[model samples]
Target: MELATKRNHAGEKADLRALVNGQYKGDEHALIERIAADLLAGVSARAGEKPGAGKIVGLSSKAACREIASRLAEWLIRETDRAVDARPSCLPAARWSPEEVLERTGMSKSTLYRGDHAQFYSVVPPGKKNGRAYPAWQFIADVPSHLPHLLEILRSNSRMQVNTFFLSEQESLDDLSPAEVLAGMPFEDRQIVASAQQRMLALPVRARVNKVNALARMEVADLG
Candidate 1:
């Protein structure tokens, strides 16, 4: 009897021609399909039958349905065994690409290339090719140690409040007035806004004092 072809989660039909031609050496696809078909048929038959009436729907008897289910279970066991035996030797370890590493780390390309602290992380060159791929094992090994610091940085970065007045990377820090900063801050942290404003006010004053001190030192040197 011809078996019904199965489709994947994406609704695309699974290619079983390769398995039928012996190109693949596993019966998992066939076993799963057979089991699913049997279950579906059983459900349909049960739905058609009235409860407590003991009336057979599609099958000759309930015993026939039980036999079909038992056969499917046996076939599943055999297929599972075949699948286990067909697994490749290099199945445990899988290497990830640079893009994947970035995704996991949440670090930008620049940050990954040159870390924030200049020498926190090191990149290993690809083994087979001269490309920019690191060993997945190395990433796994280093994660436990580096993760805490990375998480702290990410947390602090997220907490930082930015607005139109406050330019983080460039522009004037003074451009963002204390009131502006307070306005941008989340409502929950509004109580701490006063302290933040005081700190911001101190920064420009400290800068001005430093500039005056430098000028005074230059004048002394010139006079001498």
Candidate 2:
């Protein structure tokens, strides 16, 4: 609803509670009916009409309504993730090319690319093709020891999203970014890993799955 209102798809104001009219009666089918009706109404409004002006007369069947409602939920998750990704803080501080990574870490190309020594944070830079860039912070000090565990929790996130997770200051970590904390000595891996889990949980399930699928597709492209 916030996304719809902000995008001007839902004009003036939008409230989910406002849609409740005592007709639900705790029935699951009725709940779907309400969601499908509002979803259809919103779609029509996007085409050029008042949000509630769309009629449900041609919905066809309950199955169709359920499908529409499911699609609507997925769209909301996607839009929300887009909004999150648009922040400048989502970008890594520095990205190193393969040669730069090899020079800085003094590791063999075979070891570096194999991801055996370090689970290097890999990402494709904007407008680039045929390669991946590694975020610089992942190789900082003892941080590499804790990186694989943290990355496991954030595997579903896009590389930028993972950057955002690590670079942004967290209230849970005494207002230090995970990178800052991990770069220092005596940090508990559990604390940082738990912080990552909390952040990941904030995203919708399908959004996480979408990010995971997107990352997998990018990996396949890189392999090709």
Candidate 3:
């Protein structure tokens, strides 16, 4: 209903709750997809009736379809994760090139492009081709001090996981993002290092590569 009616945030929350709590329920993932498609049909019908007003809420058809698809994908993933094994999901919100990263981190291009690129940062395949882009979270205040060291202690290797560790929230640090805490200099680093050590002990030694790869796959499908 929210997708079809183009409701605002609060309206969407209400509609979503009603939809979830209503009499209709089936395979959670499939039901959401089917409902989304049905809503999209209503959207299409509205568009067909008035060519210019088809957008329903001033959004282009392509954009609306993309939004619907991503919402559905996210719903499915969330439900699936709840029912099965849960995993960390890092939003690939920003990517920077070597030059941009060098400018941000004040690190040499040689170090960034080194054989062990995963040590300092995680690289994503570029949309253009033939190059990799670094996730911006790898560096905070031009420092990657905790990322490399923390990732190593986890016995997990991946620049993407490194970024995830930095981005993950730490309760010991009063719900602060690890990167935000790590960015603090001098006198503040004791807890930062201690929390990193404690979290490292808590983290299981498993292949940390899957989460980033899954995130990238979602992007390729435009479900990001």
**TM-score (all chains, Cα) for each model:** 0.21, 0.38, 0.33
- Candidate 1, residue 26: the lDDT equals 41
How many residue pairs of model 3 clash at the backbone? Answer: 0
Please give the clash total of every predicted structure, in order. Answer: 0, 0, 0
Badly placed stretches (over 4 Å) of model 1 are 1-47, 51-61, 85-91, 95-224
Worst 10 residues of 3 by lDDT: 83-92
User: In terms of lDDT, which candidate is stronger, 1 or 2?
Assistant: 2
- Among these predictions, the greatest lDDT belongs to 2
- Candidate ordering by lDDT (highest first): 2, 3, 1
TM-score winner between 1 and 2, please give it.
2
Candidate 2 structure quality by residue, lDDT tens digits, 1-224: 87865644322111111112111113334444566766666676676855555344565445456677676546543343443344222223677988988876556788677773236577776697757788766654334444554566556666766666666665644455556555442123334445554455345534444444444445445545
Q: Per-residue CA lDDT of candidate 1, range 111-160, in tens?
A: 55654222132233435534454333223211222222332332222112
Better of 2 and 3 by TM-score: 2
> What does candidate 2 score on TM?
0.38
lDDT (0-100) at residue 116 of candidate 1?
A: 24
Highest TM-score: give the candidate number: 2
Q: lDDT tens string, model 3, 1-224?
A: 85655534433432333233221123445545545655666668765744223564667655665567679758554544443232112222477777786774445678667623434555566555456777654443322322444444433435555455556655644454555444432223234445554454334323223332333343334521
Estimate the TM-score for candidate 3: 0.33
RMSD of 3: 17.3
Relative to the true structure, how large is the alpha-carbon lDDT of every model? 0.36, 0.51, 0.47
Question: What ranges in model 2 sit over 4 Å off?
Answer: 1-92, 116-118, 185-224
